[model samples]
Target: MNSSNHSIWFYAVATVLSVALGFFVASHYSTSEPVYHHAQLLPQPRALPEMALVDQQGKSIGNNLWRNRWSLVFFGFTSCPDICPLELQKLASLLRLADASAKLQVVFISVDPERDTSARLREYVNFFHPDIVALSGSNTELANTANFFGAAYDRSVIIESKLFSVPAGIDMPVNAGNAYQVNHSARVFIVNPQGAYAGSFMPPFDAPQLWGDIKQLIKQ
Candidate 1:
């Protein structure tokens, strides 16, 4: 081959090798990525409204608490019959399995503020995960917070052998004993370290699946 031809061939070979190397690296990273089950990454992150809330220790927590670390937030009441307990237990197990260095934070925001006081929430949350933070506020505060996340709630009271609506504005059905329940969507919100809504995990969160997804976030 002529010198010019040889130079061109050598350059082509180098370029091909470089491209191959890049592909290999990319593939390796992709395969090593942790697999998440039942959770989808948001197309674009959404912003949260400014709402005031108090933590287990009565510490103010809201958008400000979201700063500095990733958080997994859930909204439920202490009186929740089955779903709340099950979810909390599963999360506790996952936390135990996750690496200590990862230090994932979990927040339980109570939708039933009428029954979920700061003290009650603290005690309830501590039973499942000591590291978990329980947050609750007055009815007005909670309503504002819930509205920000589009969470709907309603109160059903039994009066004079029939169910009647109280002054409180909630979105639930009427039931017996004035013991009404709040039905809300189950979404495990994943917030980025910068307090941005990273994504959300829907439901049927197996421990392994959650661990994998959370591990991926920790690495990121």
Candidate 2:
């Protein structure tokens, strides 16, 4: 095979191995202690920027919301097909395994504000777990807040003239934007108990290691 074909074959093999390993880890990963794989901690925790985001209760929240408890913040729209709900469930499992003595919470920020109104967001997040607080706001507000965590997303509108609208939380891609897709960050940004931007946990997330590290971080 030529060099170009060799490179493609190498990547294809790597991709297949990765998918197989992910399945193996997922199937056998039981609730137990584990060593963290790729946890990145910042040199210093950064204060969140002020953004007028509304909580699940439809109350306005400022940056102060990050102050009281350690938060596992993930930026994803409710309509996300697979990763979003799986990530939140992993965070929820972390809470279940984590030391309950310390205060910890999950924050789900919607990137699709046009469809994820406060009411829509609340309903979507509540399906996972009640303690998981969902937040949504104006596009600018979301952008500002997301920037603070180095998170970014973009909506790819279908170029075709066909039009359709789907409710939030539906997995179907053919939506009101004429079959568009909103891609957002998958990293779960971690905040300290004092609500400072501590670090992040990248996927493929291992609940045991993540919660264990979070429990330790909350103590710091």
RMSD of each: 5.0, 15.2
| Candidate 2 segments exceeding 4 Å error | 1-36, 159-178
Worst 10 residues of 1 by lDDT: 167-176
lDDT, candidate 1, 79-121, per-residue tens: 8888889898887787888787776788888877667778889
Report clash pairs, candidate 2: none
For all predicted structures, in order, the TM-scores are 0.76, 0.74
RMSD of 1: 5.0
Which number leads on TM-score? 1
- Global lDDT of each candidate: 0.76, 0.78
Worst 10 residues of 2 by lDDT: 163-172
